[model samples]
Target: MKTTAAPGSPAGLLVLWTLTRTALLLCVLKVIVFPGPDVTSDVSVIYRGWYDVLSAGTFPQDDVTWQYPPAAALAILSPGLLPFLGYATAFFVLALVADLVTLALLLYAGRGPGRARRGAWVWVAGVPLLGPTVYARYDVMVTAVAVAALLAGVRHPRVMGALVGFGALLKVWPALLLVGVRRRGAWVSAVVTGAGVAVLFAVLMPGAFAFLTFQKDRGTEVESLGALVFHVARHHGWEGEVLLNYGSVEFLGPYVNWVSTGALFLTGAALVWLVVWRALARRLEPHTVADAAFVGVLLFTTTSRVISPQYMVWLVGLAAVCLCFRDSRMGAPVVLVLGACLVTVLEFPVWFAHVVASDALGVSLLVVRNGLLVAAAVLGGRRLWHATVPGWRGVAGVPGPAPAAETPVAP
Candidate 1:
């Protein structure tokens, strides 16, 4: 039997054409007409400071050292030569290009699905009222490498492992790629590449390795699990004390000390167990890597002590990859992430000015932003029901095309 789905009507096609033209025009206007003031902060400040350090022949920590791994500074300082865009604009455009690369990698990986899946990246670029595309951050470069690494994982597992190991040096999140990858050869490759990158890094800055070794001494954080406990304690007015419970160290907020390590360990254990479940069940599919990575990133953002806006760049780039998923159900997470980003842009750019001026309006936007992310999680989890292990997994003793945990999810 043959089924013929009707082609999109002329009217529908016309609407899409009109929207694309409007989006592109708006993008140009955004770039030319509204040359925004440099009001953004975080890695913007970090990157500029790094440039000064480089020009002065001093490593970052010697002056105003930020917490990122050393290789991240190389990425941050890359746009220095483009005087016209300023370090900021050049960095911004490069970030957008990186996102395009992520989109391409996603499309290439999912090409087996069909054209509609591949063409979805085009529609994603047209999603109107999206957040500002340019923000200064290393997330873009790392994300570009990370997405490329994911594609390479399927085609060139050894290279993928190497890329991820290097990317992990830039930002710790890339380490998660090791979970979904099952090959023993890839693991050895990752260890070898990571060691080589580490050796080069050592030569670059004689003391960097020592700094990294003591990296854990930096500080827990106000935004993290044990810190949150301290925050609630302070509000109620209690004596705060620090304790190491079963390997996890914690501190109370504001004071930065006095937390139960035991509680932290328990909480961490639960989260780690959940991650293992997601991995063991093959819940995070290769085609859904973009979606899963966003969830992983948000897990870091929402749970970690810092909520830097530039971090949004990482998730947004991955969102582009998820949108490239041919499955509509798989693509829903992209829509949620898109909404969250627009709110992120609105929240800042003026530092709570719009929010505090009209509290309800600001709160509404925040609610919408988090709500959409929550929805994306639901859609992504549902993918567990439909995902089928590839033939390659058969060699690894994983079943082929097994029935999903439930029915096919509507992406």
Candidate 2:
């Protein structure tokens, strides 16, 4: 197997990054911009609805598929403002912009005194490796906000909160970052600002709360880790059925709801563990908050009843941010995450039919992918825990934290 290029070797890192960037750029050119009906449908179809909402100044209350918060309306309408750009082109441009912004953040942050470029390496490599799904969905926008929030979490806690709050409006997952905030006032600021923005939109937008009811009726998504159990059971005469619902592949038969509930319960349990871990950590490194946030998101993503292919983008994004911290010691786990991203691409557009059929290839893909996610989560969680433990001894001869692991820079 090919080993990770050494972090100390700038030449090796450059070569790898260049190759990843080129490959990703080509993937975008061929897959996203030049996609067939299936791909365009994902992008243009959603764009049309958002454009209509913007032009008419109305929420998609009547549309069953519009399940996001009212703040999402702003995101949907954003690309429409691009001058002379068609909806699809504008959407693609917006996705590219988000990707570029994330890369810029990682690159700039890596240049700081104590930071490392490994996180940038992760972003450059992981995003493209995730395939065209990066542009097919709006997840990249939320990821950009997430990157900004994490980079600012220590130095400017309130700013971090505001960014995360705005991100949560676009997608609920970003709010999870609030749990990683260090200061009591800072955490409160993030919560209040995020909640305040959400409440403001709820009051002004018609369909702001519509998503809650809509989600209540959702079946377990076929791609979720929970669905893996059903996929295996399908071979042994399980009666569950799979179908495309609410824009995702989901299980719609007996016990599907039960599986979803179980997943939610597990997620809740994970959150509780995280809160306790943060409270009790003996030595909390500056990077601990970002690393903890990464672990929390990994738990949320892997355990949730929905694991869209694009979900990998969120996973890799946070993982990349965490790896930027020199002391994160996430090298092994991040490599696994990158490998998982590649497998996800194969499991998705390449062989999604097999996945739907629960065939050997599909099941195998899911197995490898989900297993990696589980491993990444476990390893990442463990590394974060050890890194934060107070008075922890360093490896052998090393006594203090590594130079790259110094306190985070103030913004």
Superposition TM-score, candidate 2 onto the true structure: 0.88
Number of the top candidate by TM-score? 2
Give one clash count per candidate, in the order shown: 10, 1
Error of 1 at 16 (Å): 11
Residue-wise lDDT of candidate 1 within 1-411, one digit each (tens)? Answer: 632322343234335434544443344334533233343343456567667775654455543245566567567777875777766657766655665565456555555653244333433342333334343445767877877776676557788788878888788778766654556666778788877887786677644443354334434432233344454454466565444321123343344532434434544653584376455544344444444455555454544444344566666655555555554345555666666666666654433343323345544554555566556655554442234332223343333344434323111
TM-score (all chains, Cα) for each model: 0.67, 0.88
lDDT for position 402 in model 2: 51
Please give the CA lDDT of all the candidate structures.
0.52, 0.77
Cα RMSD for candidates in order: 8.3, 4.6
Give candidate 1's error at residue 291 in angstroms. Answer: 5.2
